[model samples]
Target: MNKPPRKKNPTFGIAIFIVVAVLLVIATLFYNAITEKREFDRQNAPEPTISSDAAAAAATTAKPASGAAQ
Candidate 1:
């Protein structure tokens, strides 16, 4: 008895892989856009700035030793 021919296409598998890769790249770009928008919105929100005196006081408080002459 003669056996029938099998249909095996290697190009089909490569095409599927290429499609999945493109989808992943698109997803990454979408996710980056969302995160950047959120971060930009947060930056635009009102935030208090530290005054020079407050910054100086914080530095003094954080010092490990007194500023005595050696």
Candidate 2:
């Protein structure tokens, strides 16, 4: 039985390697950026200014539906 002739160019393997290498590099950079951003946000996120007392008062004073029968 005769086997099929193989193509000479090794470009398929080289292309696959290059794509994987680029993907790994991009993934590393993206992960690093996301982690840094998350950490920075965690450290710098704003604190709510409303006091607990004011929040409680507002909740208690909130009105019901205006169209509802009393």
Candidate 3:
């Protein structure tokens, strides 16, 4: 029987690998840049304030949800 042709060159796979690696590097750098900017903004932000009554309400509702999950 005649043998069908298979992938003879590994260059295509190597090129794909290089492209993916470059894309990943770009993504990592972009993510890091955004996080650094966010950190800077967070540090400069003013202290947040919330009502004690609302906080207590949230805390009370949280316990029953946890118990019901059991």
Per-model TM-score versus the true fold: 0.58, 0.60, 0.56
In Å, residue 38's CA in model 3 sits off its true spot by: 0.2
lDDT of 3 at 27: 100
Winner by TM-score between candidate 3 and candidate 1? 1
Best-to-worst order by TM-score is: 2, 1, 3
Model 3: how far residue 40 lies from native, Å: 0.4
Q: lDDT per residue, candidate 2, 9-66, as tens digits? A: 8998999999999999999999999999999999998886779668988989959799
Q: How good is model 1 by TM-score?
A: 0.58
- Weakest 10 consecutive residues, lDDT, candidate 1? 61-70
Angstrom error at residue 9, model 3:
1.1
Clashes of 1: 0
> Least accurate stretch of 10 residues (summed lDDT) in model 2?
47-56
Candidate 3 — which pairs collide? Answer: none
lDDT of each: 0.88, 0.92, 0.87
Candidate ranking (lDDT, best to worst): 2, 1, 3
The most accurate candidate by lDDT is: 2
